[model samples]
Target: MAKQAKNHAHRRMTHQRQVISDCLKTLNHPTVDEIQTCVIRTAPTINKATIYRTMNRMVEDGEVIRIVGDDGAFHYDATLDAHYHMLCEECGALSDVDMPVLPQIDQYFPPDSDFRLTGHDVIFRGICSKCRAKKAGRNRAETGQN
Candidate 1:
Protein backbone atom coordinates (compact mmCIF):
# COMPACT_ATOMS: atom_id res chain seq x y z
CA MET A 1 0.00 0.00 0.00
CA ALA A 2 2.79 2.41 0.85
CA LYS A 3 4.56 1.65 -2.41
CA GLN A 4 1.36 2.23 -4.38
CA ALA A 5 0.70 5.50 -2.57
CA LYS A 6 4.27 6.65 -3.20
CA ASN A 7 3.95 5.81 -6.89
CA HIS A 8 0.71 7.72 -7.16
CA ALA A 9 2.27 10.72 -5.49
CA HIS A 10 5.25 10.50 -7.78
CA ARG A 11 3.00 10.43 -10.81
CA ARG A 12 1.32 13.64 -9.74
CA MET A 13 4.35 15.65 -8.61
CA THR A 14 6.59 16.44 -11.57
CA HIS A 15 8.06 19.94 -11.93
CA GLN A 16 5.66 20.82 -14.72
CA ARG A 17 2.85 19.11 -12.84
CA GLN A 18 3.46 21.23 -9.76
CA VAL A 19 3.60 24.42 -11.83
CA ILE A 20 0.38 23.55 -13.68
CA SER A 21 -1.40 22.70 -10.42
CA ASP A 22 -0.24 25.97 -8.90
CA CYS A 23 -1.48 27.94 -11.87
CA LEU A 24 -4.89 26.22 -11.76
CA LYS A 25 -5.25 26.81 -8.04
CA THR A 26 -4.63 30.53 -8.44
CA LEU A 27 -7.48 31.33 -10.82
CA ASN A 28 -11.07 30.31 -11.54
CA HIS A 29 -10.61 29.85 -15.29
CA PRO A 30 -7.24 30.48 -16.89
CA THR A 31 -6.28 29.94 -20.51
CA VAL A 32 -3.27 27.88 -21.50
CA ASP A 33 -1.34 30.98 -22.42
CA GLU A 34 -2.14 32.60 -19.12
CA ILE A 35 -1.03 29.49 -17.25
CA GLN A 36 2.09 29.25 -19.34
CA THR A 37 3.01 32.79 -18.43
CA CYS A 38 2.58 32.09 -14.74
CA VAL A 39 4.52 28.83 -14.94
CA ILE A 40 7.32 30.55 -16.80
CA ARG A 41 7.63 33.06 -14.00
CA THR A 42 8.23 30.31 -11.46
CA ALA A 43 9.94 27.71 -13.63
CA PRO A 44 11.78 29.55 -16.36
CA THR A 45 13.22 26.26 -17.59
CA ILE A 46 9.75 24.93 -18.38
CA ASN A 47 8.54 25.45 -21.93
CA LYS A 48 5.06 25.82 -23.44
CA ALA A 49 5.00 22.23 -24.60
CA THR A 50 5.56 20.95 -21.08
CA ILE A 51 2.82 23.18 -19.75
CA TYR A 52 0.33 22.02 -22.38
CA ARG A 53 1.17 18.37 -21.91
CA THR A 54 0.90 18.62 -18.12
CA MET A 55 -2.40 20.42 -18.32
CA ASN A 56 -3.79 17.82 -20.72
CA ARG A 57 -2.64 15.02 -18.45
CA MET A 58 -4.22 16.71 -15.46
CA VAL A 59 -7.50 17.04 -17.34
CA GLU A 60 -7.38 13.38 -18.35
CA ASP A 61 -6.72 12.37 -14.73
CA GLY A 62 -9.77 14.34 -13.57
CA GLU A 63 -7.63 16.83 -11.66
CA VAL A 64 -8.90 19.72 -13.76
CA ILE A 65 -11.71 20.60 -16.16
CA ARG A 66 -11.38 22.34 -19.52
CA ILE A 67 -13.85 25.07 -20.49
CA VAL A 68 -14.07 26.32 -24.04
CA GLY A 69 -15.12 29.90 -24.34
CA ASP A 70 -16.75 31.67 -27.28
CA ASP A 71 -13.37 33.28 -28.05
CA GLY A 72 -12.06 29.87 -29.15
CA ALA A 73 -9.73 29.56 -26.18
CA PHE A 74 -9.66 26.71 -23.68
CA HIS A 75 -9.76 27.67 -19.99
CA TYR A 76 -8.77 25.38 -17.17
CA ASP A 77 -10.80 25.08 -13.98
CA ALA A 78 -9.44 23.37 -10.93
CA THR A 79 -12.85 22.66 -9.50
CA LEU A 80 -13.89 19.13 -10.42
CA ASP A 81 -17.53 19.24 -9.40
CA ALA A 82 -20.72 19.94 -11.31
CA HIS A 83 -21.19 23.69 -11.55
CA TYR A 84 -21.83 26.54 -13.95
CA HIS A 85 -19.86 29.61 -15.01
CA MET A 86 -20.64 33.11 -16.19
CA LEU A 87 -18.41 35.00 -18.61
CA CYS A 88 -18.29 38.74 -18.93
CA GLU A 89 -18.42 39.44 -22.60
CA GLU A 90 -16.81 42.83 -22.37
CA CYS A 91 -13.96 42.20 -19.96
CA GLY A 92 -13.50 38.46 -20.42
CA ALA A 93 -13.93 37.83 -16.72
CA LEU A 94 -15.08 34.36 -15.70
CA SER A 95 -17.02 33.69 -12.53
CA ASP A 96 -18.68 30.69 -10.95
CA VAL A 97 -22.38 30.71 -10.13
CA ASP A 98 -23.45 28.96 -6.98
CA MET A 99 -26.50 26.72 -7.03
CA PRO A 100 -28.15 24.90 -4.19
CA VAL A 101 -29.14 22.21 -6.63
CA LEU A 102 -29.07 21.49 -10.30
CA PRO A 103 -32.25 22.45 -12.13
CA GLN A 104 -34.53 19.67 -13.30
CA ILE A 105 -35.14 20.14 -17.02
CA ASP A 106 -36.03 16.57 -17.87
CA GLN A 107 -39.69 17.30 -17.26
CA TYR A 108 -39.69 20.11 -19.81
CA PHE A 109 -38.15 18.09 -22.62
CA PRO A 110 -39.95 15.55 -24.75
CA PRO A 111 -38.71 11.97 -24.82
CA ASP A 112 -38.30 12.05 -28.59
CA SER A 113 -36.29 15.24 -28.65
CA ASP A 114 -33.15 13.18 -29.27
CA PHE A 115 -31.23 15.41 -26.88
CA ARG A 116 -29.66 13.45 -24.12
CA LEU A 117 -29.26 15.59 -21.01
CA THR A 118 -26.05 14.19 -19.68
CA GLY A 119 -24.89 17.59 -18.39
CA HIS A 120 -25.35 21.29 -18.97
CA ASP A 121 -23.36 24.53 -18.75
CA VAL A 122 -25.19 27.77 -17.99
CA ILE A 123 -23.00 30.74 -18.87
CA PHE A 124 -24.42 34.23 -18.57
CA ARG A 125 -22.73 36.54 -21.03
CA GLY A 126 -22.97 40.24 -20.25
CA ILE A 127 -20.91 43.30 -19.67
CA CYS A 128 -18.98 43.17 -16.42
CA SER A 129 -18.75 45.91 -13.82
CA LYS A 130 -15.46 47.28 -15.08
CA CYS A 131 -16.74 47.46 -18.63
CA ARG A 132 -19.88 49.16 -17.46
CA ALA A 133 -17.78 51.70 -15.63
CA LYS A 134 -15.69 52.29 -18.74
CA LYS A 135 -18.83 52.83 -20.79
CA ALA A 136 -20.11 55.25 -18.20
CA GLY A 137 -16.84 57.14 -18.36
CA ARG A 138 -17.11 57.33 -22.15
CA ASN A 139 -20.64 58.62 -21.85
CA ARG A 140 -19.51 61.27 -19.41
CA ALA A 141 -16.67 62.24 -21.73
CA GLU A 142 -19.04 62.55 -24.66
CA THR A 143 -21.41 64.75 -22.63
CA GLY A 144 -18.49 67.19 -21.96
CA GLN A 145 -19.37 67.43 -18.27
CA ASN A 146 -17.86 65.95 -15.06
Candidate 2:
Protein backbone atom coordinates (compact mmCIF):
# COMPACT_ATOMS: atom_id res chain seq x y z
CA MET A 1 0.00 0.00 0.00
CA ALA A 2 2.85 2.37 0.78
CA LYS A 3 4.41 1.75 -2.62
CA GLN A 4 1.08 2.36 -4.30
CA ALA A 5 0.67 5.64 -2.43
CA LYS A 6 4.10 6.81 -3.53
CA ASN A 7 3.32 5.90 -7.12
CA HIS A 8 0.09 7.86 -6.99
CA ALA A 9 1.93 10.90 -5.70
CA HIS A 10 4.46 10.65 -8.51
CA ARG A 11 1.69 10.42 -11.07
CA ARG A 12 0.02 13.49 -9.66
CA MET A 13 3.22 15.49 -9.89
CA THR A 14 3.76 14.29 -13.45
CA HIS A 15 0.28 15.40 -14.40
CA GLN A 16 0.87 18.84 -12.96
CA ARG A 17 4.17 19.14 -14.78
CA GLN A 18 2.55 18.10 -18.05
CA VAL A 19 -0.13 20.72 -17.57
CA ILE A 20 2.49 23.43 -17.10
CA SER A 21 4.55 22.21 -20.02
CA ASP A 22 1.55 22.10 -22.33
CA CYS A 23 0.60 25.63 -21.35
CA LEU A 24 4.07 26.89 -22.19
CA LYS A 25 4.15 24.97 -25.45
CA THR A 26 0.90 26.46 -26.66
CA LEU A 27 1.92 30.02 -25.86
CA ASN A 28 5.14 31.39 -27.27
CA HIS A 29 6.12 33.44 -24.22
CA PRO A 30 3.61 33.59 -21.40
CA THR A 31 3.99 35.56 -18.22
CA VAL A 32 3.69 33.79 -14.88
CA ASP A 33 0.28 35.31 -14.31
CA GLU A 34 -0.92 34.06 -17.67
CA ILE A 35 0.40 30.62 -16.95
CA GLN A 36 -1.31 30.64 -13.59
CA THR A 37 -4.60 31.45 -15.31
CA CYS A 38 -4.06 28.57 -17.72
CA VAL A 39 -3.26 26.24 -14.86
CA ILE A 40 -6.50 27.11 -13.17
CA ARG A 41 -8.39 26.30 -16.32
CA THR A 42 -6.87 22.84 -16.54
CA ALA A 43 -6.34 22.02 -12.89
CA PRO A 44 -8.40 24.16 -10.60
CA THR A 45 -6.97 22.51 -7.51
CA ILE A 46 -3.42 23.62 -8.31
CA ASN A 47 -2.42 26.67 -6.31
CA LYS A 48 -0.40 29.62 -7.59
CA ALA A 49 2.44 28.82 -5.19
CA THR A 50 2.75 25.31 -6.55
CA ILE A 51 2.89 26.63 -10.09
CA TYR A 52 5.58 29.12 -9.14
CA ARG A 53 7.66 26.47 -7.39
CA THR A 54 7.34 24.09 -10.32
CA MET A 55 8.33 26.77 -12.81
CA ASN A 56 11.41 27.68 -10.74
CA ARG A 57 12.41 24.05 -10.47
CA MET A 58 11.93 23.53 -14.20
CA VAL A 59 14.15 26.54 -14.93
CA GLU A 60 16.87 25.15 -12.65
CA ASP A 61 16.59 21.77 -14.37
CA GLY A 62 16.94 23.40 -17.80
CA GLU A 63 13.50 22.27 -18.84
CA VAL A 64 12.35 25.85 -19.44
CA ILE A 65 13.64 29.43 -19.60
CA ARG A 66 12.52 32.62 -17.86
CA ILE A 67 12.64 35.74 -20.03
CA VAL A 68 12.32 39.20 -18.50
CA GLY A 69 10.56 41.56 -20.83
CA ASP A 70 10.63 45.37 -20.89
CA ASP A 71 7.30 45.42 -19.08
CA GLY A 72 9.00 43.84 -16.05
CA ALA A 73 6.94 40.70 -16.40
CA PHE A 74 8.81 37.41 -16.41
CA HIS A 75 7.74 35.17 -19.28
CA TYR A 76 8.29 31.43 -19.57
CA ASP A 77 9.37 29.48 -22.62
CA ALA A 78 9.57 25.72 -22.97
CA THR A 79 12.09 25.77 -25.80
CA LEU A 80 15.42 25.42 -24.02
CA ASP A 81 17.53 25.56 -27.18
CA ALA A 82 19.25 28.80 -28.20
CA HIS A 83 17.27 30.99 -30.57
CA TYR A 84 16.42 34.63 -31.08
CA HIS A 85 13.08 36.10 -30.14
CA MET A 86 11.09 38.79 -31.92
CA LEU A 87 8.74 40.83 -29.79
CA CYS A 88 5.92 42.97 -31.14
CA GLU A 89 5.99 46.36 -29.47
CA GLU A 90 2.35 47.05 -30.25
CA CYS A 91 0.70 43.73 -29.43
CA GLY A 92 3.39 42.21 -27.22
CA ALA A 93 3.49 39.07 -29.36
CA LEU A 94 6.60 36.92 -29.06
CA SER A 95 7.82 34.72 -31.88
CA ASP A 96 10.95 32.71 -32.63
CA VAL A 97 13.31 33.76 -35.43
CA ASP A 98 15.43 31.12 -37.10
CA MET A 99 18.91 32.00 -38.30
CA PRO A 100 21.11 29.16 -39.49
CA VAL A 101 24.19 31.38 -39.50
CA LEU A 102 23.94 32.27 -35.84
CA PRO A 103 26.12 29.35 -34.74
CA GLN A 104 28.99 30.50 -36.98
CA ILE A 105 29.53 33.60 -34.83
CA ASP A 106 31.10 31.47 -32.15
CA GLN A 107 33.92 30.39 -34.47
CA TYR A 108 35.06 33.98 -35.02
CA PHE A 109 35.93 34.39 -31.34
CA PRO A 110 39.25 33.17 -30.01
CA PRO A 111 39.18 29.85 -28.21
CA ASP A 112 40.85 31.33 -25.14
CA SER A 113 39.21 34.71 -25.15
CA ASP A 114 39.29 36.43 -21.78
CA PHE A 115 35.56 36.91 -21.84
CA ARG A 116 33.31 33.92 -21.43
CA LEU A 117 30.30 33.74 -23.75
CA THR A 118 27.85 31.00 -22.98
CA GLY A 119 25.11 32.21 -25.36
CA HIS A 120 23.40 35.25 -26.84
CA ASP A 121 19.89 36.66 -26.91
CA VAL A 122 18.72 38.87 -29.78
CA ILE A 123 15.28 40.46 -29.51
CA PHE A 124 13.86 42.52 -32.32
CA ARG A 125 11.00 44.80 -31.36
CA GLY A 126 8.55 46.26 -33.83
CA ILE A 127 4.90 46.41 -34.73
CA CYS A 128 3.52 43.06 -35.74
CA SER A 129 1.52 42.39 -38.92
CA LYS A 130 -1.85 42.76 -37.22
CA CYS A 131 -0.96 46.05 -35.60
CA ARG A 132 0.50 47.41 -38.83
CA ALA A 133 -2.67 46.54 -40.68
CA LYS A 134 -4.76 48.22 -38.02
CA LYS A 135 -2.72 51.39 -38.29
CA ALA A 136 -3.10 51.39 -42.04
CA GLY A 137 -6.85 50.95 -41.73
CA ARG A 138 -7.07 53.86 -39.34
CA ASN A 139 -5.13 56.07 -41.74
CA ARG A 140 -7.40 55.08 -44.66
CA ALA A 141 -10.48 55.85 -42.61
CA GLU A 142 -9.11 59.29 -41.69
CA THR A 143 -8.27 60.05 -45.34
CA GLY A 144 -11.75 58.99 -46.52
CA GLN A 145 -13.38 61.47 -44.13
CA ASN A 146 -11.12 64.33 -45.22
Candidate 3:
Protein backbone atom coordinates (compact mmCIF):
# COMPACT_ATOMS: atom_id res chain seq x y z
CA MET A 1 0.00 0.00 0.00
CA ALA A 2 1.17 3.52 -0.63
CA LYS A 3 1.98 5.86 2.22
CA GLN A 4 -0.97 7.73 3.61
CA ALA A 5 -1.52 11.31 2.65
CA LYS A 6 -1.17 13.78 5.48
CA ASN A 7 -4.52 14.71 7.03
CA HIS A 8 -6.24 12.31 4.66
CA ALA A 9 -7.05 8.63 4.77
CA HIS A 10 -5.06 6.19 2.67
CA ARG A 11 -6.59 6.06 -0.77
CA ARG A 12 -7.31 2.58 -2.00
CA MET A 13 -5.62 1.48 -5.20
CA THR A 14 -8.31 1.49 -7.84
CA HIS A 15 -8.05 -0.07 -11.29
CA GLN A 16 -7.15 3.21 -12.88
CA ARG A 17 -4.59 4.01 -10.19
CA GLN A 18 -3.00 0.61 -10.66
CA VAL A 19 -2.76 1.20 -14.37
CA ILE A 20 -1.19 4.58 -13.80
CA SER A 21 1.32 3.13 -11.33
CA ASP A 22 2.32 0.37 -13.70
CA CYS A 23 2.85 2.86 -16.51
CA LEU A 24 4.97 5.06 -14.26
CA LYS A 25 7.23 2.13 -13.36
CA THR A 26 7.70 1.19 -16.97
CA LEU A 27 8.69 4.69 -17.95
CA ASN A 28 12.14 6.02 -17.07
CA HIS A 29 10.95 9.47 -16.02
CA PRO A 30 7.93 10.81 -17.76
CA THR A 31 5.97 14.02 -17.70
CA VAL A 32 2.19 14.23 -17.25
CA ASP A 33 1.65 14.48 -20.99
CA GLU A 34 3.83 11.44 -21.58
CA ILE A 35 2.04 9.51 -18.88
CA GLN A 36 -1.41 10.46 -20.11
CA THR A 37 -0.42 9.50 -23.63
CA CYS A 38 0.80 6.10 -22.46
CA VAL A 39 -2.23 5.61 -20.21
CA ILE A 40 -4.69 6.17 -23.02
CA ARG A 41 -3.31 3.07 -24.73
CA THR A 42 -4.56 0.78 -21.95
CA ALA A 43 -7.40 2.94 -20.66
CA PRO A 44 -8.98 4.69 -23.57
CA THR A 45 -11.41 6.69 -21.47
CA ILE A 46 -8.99 8.11 -18.94
CA ASN A 47 -8.92 11.88 -19.20
CA LYS A 48 -6.32 14.53 -18.49
CA ALA A 49 -8.02 15.75 -15.32
CA THR A 50 -8.09 12.22 -13.95
CA ILE A 51 -4.40 11.82 -14.66
CA TYR A 52 -3.62 15.12 -13.00
CA ARG A 53 -5.64 14.36 -9.90
CA THR A 54 -4.33 10.84 -9.60
CA MET A 55 -0.72 11.97 -10.03
CA ASN A 56 -1.11 14.75 -7.51
CA ARG A 57 -2.70 12.34 -5.06
CA MET A 58 0.04 9.81 -5.58
CA VAL A 59 2.67 12.42 -4.84
CA GLU A 60 0.83 13.48 -1.70
CA ASP A 61 0.48 9.85 -0.68
CA GLY A 62 4.23 9.31 -1.04
CA GLU A 63 3.75 6.86 -3.88
CA VAL A 64 5.45 9.15 -6.40
CA ILE A 65 7.91 12.00 -6.61
CA ARG A 66 7.48 14.94 -8.94
CA ILE A 67 10.59 16.33 -10.57
CA VAL A 68 10.85 19.41 -12.71
CA GLY A 69 12.71 18.81 -15.93
CA ASP A 70 14.75 21.28 -17.96
CA ASP A 71 11.73 21.73 -20.19
CA GLY A 72 9.96 23.24 -17.20
CA ALA A 73 7.41 20.45 -17.04
CA PHE A 74 6.64 18.22 -14.08
CA HIS A 75 8.00 14.71 -14.41
CA TYR A 76 6.76 11.75 -12.38
CA ASP A 77 8.95 9.14 -10.73
CA ALA A 78 7.86 6.05 -8.82
CA THR A 79 11.26 4.89 -7.62
CA LEU A 80 11.33 5.82 -3.96
CA ASP A 81 14.97 4.82 -3.50
CA ALA A 82 17.41 7.55 -2.60
CA HIS A 83 19.24 8.34 -5.80
CA TYR A 84 19.99 11.14 -8.18
CA HIS A 85 19.21 11.68 -11.85
CA MET A 86 20.88 13.04 -14.97
CA LEU A 87 18.92 15.28 -17.32
CA CYS A 88 20.14 15.47 -20.90
CA GLU A 89 20.21 19.07 -21.91
CA GLU A 90 20.25 18.33 -25.61
CA CYS A 91 17.38 15.85 -25.76
CA GLY A 92 15.54 16.57 -22.54
CA ALA A 93 16.04 13.00 -21.47
CA LEU A 94 15.95 12.03 -17.79
CA SER A 95 17.60 8.93 -16.39
CA ASP A 96 18.76 7.69 -13.03
CA VAL A 97 22.42 8.11 -12.12
CA ASP A 98 23.91 4.87 -10.86
CA MET A 99 25.78 5.98 -7.77
CA PRO A 100 25.64 5.73 -4.01
CA VAL A 101 23.38 8.10 -2.17
CA LEU A 102 25.37 10.75 -0.37
CA PRO A 103 23.48 10.69 2.91
CA GLN A 104 26.30 12.66 4.47
CA ILE A 105 25.12 15.73 2.63
CA ASP A 106 22.15 15.82 4.96
CA GLN A 107 24.53 16.89 7.69
CA TYR A 108 25.27 20.14 5.91
CA PHE A 109 22.03 21.74 7.04
CA PRO A 110 22.73 24.62 9.40
CA PRO A 111 23.67 22.97 12.67
CA ASP A 112 21.78 25.51 14.72
CA SER A 113 18.79 25.94 12.47
CA ASP A 114 15.40 24.82 13.72
CA PHE A 115 14.38 23.47 10.35
CA ARG A 116 14.99 19.81 9.71
CA LEU A 117 16.53 18.70 6.45
CA THR A 118 14.20 16.00 5.17
CA GLY A 119 15.81 15.36 1.79
CA HIS A 120 17.60 16.76 -1.21
CA ASP A 121 17.42 16.44 -4.97
CA VAL A 122 20.57 16.42 -7.08
CA ILE A 123 20.17 16.68 -10.84
CA PHE A 124 23.16 16.66 -13.19
CA ARG A 125 22.53 18.39 -16.50
CA GLY A 126 24.51 17.70 -19.67
CA ILE A 127 24.40 16.27 -23.15
CA CYS A 128 23.95 12.49 -22.92
CA SER A 129 26.23 10.14 -24.85
CA LYS A 130 23.62 9.59 -27.54
CA CYS A 131 23.10 13.29 -28.01
CA ARG A 132 26.85 13.93 -28.04
CA ALA A 133 27.37 11.25 -30.67
CA LYS A 134 24.55 12.68 -32.78
CA LYS A 135 26.08 16.11 -32.54
CA ALA A 136 29.50 14.75 -33.38
CA GLY A 137 28.12 12.95 -36.41
CA ARG A 138 26.41 16.10 -37.60
CA ASN A 139 29.62 18.10 -37.15
CA ARG A 140 31.63 15.49 -39.01
CA ALA A 141 29.14 15.36 -41.85
CA GLU A 142 29.09 19.15 -42.16
CA THR A 143 32.88 19.37 -42.06
CA GLY A 144 33.30 16.53 -44.62
CA GLN A 145 35.33 14.48 -42.11
CA ASN A 146 34.90 10.77 -41.59
lDDT (C-alpha) at residue 59 in model 3 = 96
Structural similarity to truth (TM-score) of each candidate: 0.80, 0.79, 0.84
Error of 3 at 15 (Å): 1.6
* Backbone clashes, each candidate: 0, 0, 0
- Checking candidate 2 for backbone clashes, the offending pairs are none
Q: TM-score for model 1?
A: 0.80
**lDDT of each residue in 1-146, candidate 3, tens digit only:** 34446324424337779889989988889988889888999998888888999999999999999999987988899999888999999889899999998988988878899887788889998899999999998999989963
lDDT against true structure, model 1: 0.81
Model 2: per-residue Cα lDDT over 21-92, one tens digit each:
988977779987788888888899988888888899899999998887778777888887788888888877
lDDT of 1 by residue, 1-146 (tens): 99999988677557568777887788669988888888888888877777778888888998888888878788999987778888988767787878643567546667687788666667878887889999999998989974
Residue 54, candidate 2: alpha-carbon lDDT: 89
lDDT of each: 0.81, 0.85, 0.88
Best first by lDDT, ranked: 3, 2, 1
Please give the lDDT score at residue 41 for candidate 2.
89
Identify the superior model by TM-score, candidate 1 or candidate 3: 3
Off by over 4 Å in 1: 1-13, 113-116
Candidate 3 worst ten-residue window by lDDT = 4-13
Tally clashes: model 3. Answer: 0
**Candidate 3 at 43: error in angstroms?**
0.8
